[model samples]
Target: MPEAGEVAARVAERLGTMRGAPVSVESARQLPAGASRATYAATLVDAAGVPEPIIIRAVPAAEDDGGLGAEAEVLRAAADAGVPVPEILDVGLGDDSVLGFPYLAMNFIGGESIPRRILRDDTYAAARGRFVEQCGGILARVHRIDATQTPGLDELVDPVEALHALFPREFDAMPAGLVLATQWLVANPPPSSPGSCVVHGDFRLGNLLVDADGVAAVLDWELVHIGDPVEDLGWLCAKAWRFGGATPVAGMGERASLLDAYAEVAGWRPTEEALRWWELYATVKWGLICAVQANRHLDGIERSVELAAIGRRSAEQEFDALLDLGVVSPEVVPDPLGVEATVPDEEPHGSPSSFELLDALAGFLRSDSVTAEMSPQVRFHTRVAGNVVDVVRRQVLLGATHAAESAQRLAALGVADQRALCDALRSGELDGTDEKVRAAIAADVRARLLVANPKYFAVPHP
Candidate 1:
């Protein structure tokens, strides 16, 4: 809640013991990556003629009731266990005299986030392998520490419960098809064979501060919990976290290596089936989160274009999961024909610009909806509708329209309608083989991508 400048000033003051004299904030820049917490990099000058640079990470005052205290405790425990992490210089409840919110000051980690380059380039071919090793290695140590030893971290939710909690309350408002999918998932919960360990609730490449050698510090503990070790693995390799399309897992390492490294150090190798279940659960959980964020935008609590865009992608992942789960037939996917023709080559006919169109879409996304007075659940999806409309608008503007075109084309090609497609999967319409569903979803996604962004979809013969 504190202004960035104020938080930086407080951090400078807190570090006075380390450097001596009244510390003053020399500079501050907001670190822009997370959804839940606010972070800042602060440069401090201590009158003792010493230069001190510390990162000030603060949980908003609203979340301060227990999150920050819990994080500080977990970081302390991890540090004590020799897990690589920023040195915690000071932890505070924060006052008007200091920062406007509860804050923690840590030694500023120096290095580009490994994910900044590794996920996008081949220069870091070994980066993925090494990243996974460090994760498994450090987490192995984190698991070794007794949960009781970590102050204020007692009542942590298990992975299964956590997964269910992650679903958007608004999801109940989705079409009957999605509602049915939800019921199926709830009825068939992932197995909860319990284990005892401290789970890094959001451990993944992005959450880590890393460099060429390895992980500098495993950051972000707002979601830390005392639960099964595999929960961390499940979260780490969630497809949603894999910024890249599909090749690498979790935007870092190979899926097998991630498990292998953990098994090598932890002395317990997880079956691929077990990991698959968690991975699927991860997708569902993240899907719910996206849905929730979109709901926030819809409700006008937060209006972010990126959130709206990414939120719609959740269902794509869910459909992919159904394919993975063997509930749907693969190759029987509907073909694309009529759908591609409906999309205009260029809407608004190239006057202002693509950025202008996106800005217009953002504005439209924030406009008050006719369903503004609806129930909370309905309101959530009305928000989603606004976002989806913008996406269609963007696809129209950017010449990469994907989904609807594919659906129409599939229907034209003598494929069943949407209702039949859902029923076929639900009623064992195809031979009861999982591969069929997987193939079907893959084909549909490829077509949708083509419609969504044909420019990106276009390829020339070498």
Candidate 2:
């Protein structure tokens, strides 16, 4: 993370060059909540003494973010198509003299991006009711953008193929359910759409800014590409994006309402079969992404508690895929184990126990670290850290038993370990119809979810 002073200085220098006159940066601060890129809000005064609020999005120097300039172009094209998007103020600032990293700047638009708030807060109740239709219309407009107009934008030839190309290591580390879903997708491909257009690679509630009127603007165009327009529709309806709500469309409205709204504007509605295929694809895509995010942290590319937590969430997506594919019943719960509790041996004990130490750290972060003195970004990260500690605490208590049970289940399946079981499932060596395979995978996912997030099993899916 860049210091606020460094960000301010860079913004000042960049503004001076853009305006061809001296410019002053009043403040620059990091914004919370983006996972892929770093965003900074900067207030600057131009030579005319006019103050401006601008957002600068920069790719971390350590990561290969291939599309900052392309994202800017896509934003412009979306705006030209009458889609609500932030105005792109500047682009192509790759030189170290400007920002020390490639960045794009845009006029800041205000609205709420948090899904929990958007879904349950009474302030947004009206917006929640109308957001689905609004998003449907906006997505229709975005999909209408001419692919030829955006010459350099990448095309998603095959989403499944694209996902396979992501991890060249043969996916040995992924969850069995995800591997199974990928194989299923390969065997049962969706009928190709006759033509292609711009598809918002990620169009979900968190990426949308909602206000009382409806969706204020579509944000995060980094994944923008040319593909079947229905990809966006299916992504929007994905269960993972639903955020625990029973309703499919962003957890706000019915799938029929979304489809109806899209048909009203786009002149065609996708068949239920096509939508199901894409929805399944969305589940697989999200599961793979969760795995990749976890790998980023585990591999030391980015050390983040949030990323590590997201890695565990791959199980949630896998369970979702199984539910969608009819491999597991939606009501399937983790089977209770009957292991006898073992008493701890006499302590050659030291200061604080591991559990106590983690408890203390989590309590400190939650109680002291999240004060007003801390920036929102810092506070957010502190909370995430606290949550991570809590997860570790749970793992310390339950992980061993969970691992033993998982191993026993895999051994019963004639597979030595998770990797082998996943490989077997992927290669179609294990019959999907076999009750033993289904039960074992379900129980395994249940055990994993119990360690990762017990709340998932507590809440019923819609």
Give lDDT per model, in order: 0.61, 0.78
True lDDT of residue 287, candidate 2? 78
Off by over 4 Å in 2: 62-65, 170-172, 329-352, 368-372
The alpha-carbon RMSD values of the candidates against the true structure, listed in the order shown, are: 8.9, 2.9
User: What is the per-residue lDDT of model 2 for residues 38-65, given as tens digits with 9 covering 90 to 100?
Assistant: 8888888887888888888887753444
Q: Candidate 1 — which residues are off by over 4 angstroms?
A: 1-3, 17-20, 61-63, 94-97, 114-116, 121-126, 151-158, 166-194, 245-248, 326-390, 394-462
What does candidate 1 score on TM? 0.71
For model 1, residues 1-462, the per-residue Cα lDDT tens digits are 346687786567656655666788888876754444668887887676667778877766344443777788888888888788788888876453256567778888865564647566665556555777777777777777668767556443544445445453644433222433444455565555346677777887677776656677788887777776776787777655665435335665566777787778788776665666666666666667767766766776656554566666655555545544545433333223213434344465775655456556656656676555665434555565565554565455434444555466446433565455555555555332345444554455444443333332221100
Residue 159, candidate 2: alpha-carbon lDDT: 77
- TM-score of candidate 2 relative to the true fold: 0.92
Candidate 2 residue-wise lDDT at 406? 84
Minimum summed lDDT over a 10-residue window in model 1 is located at 453-462
RMSD of 1: 8.9
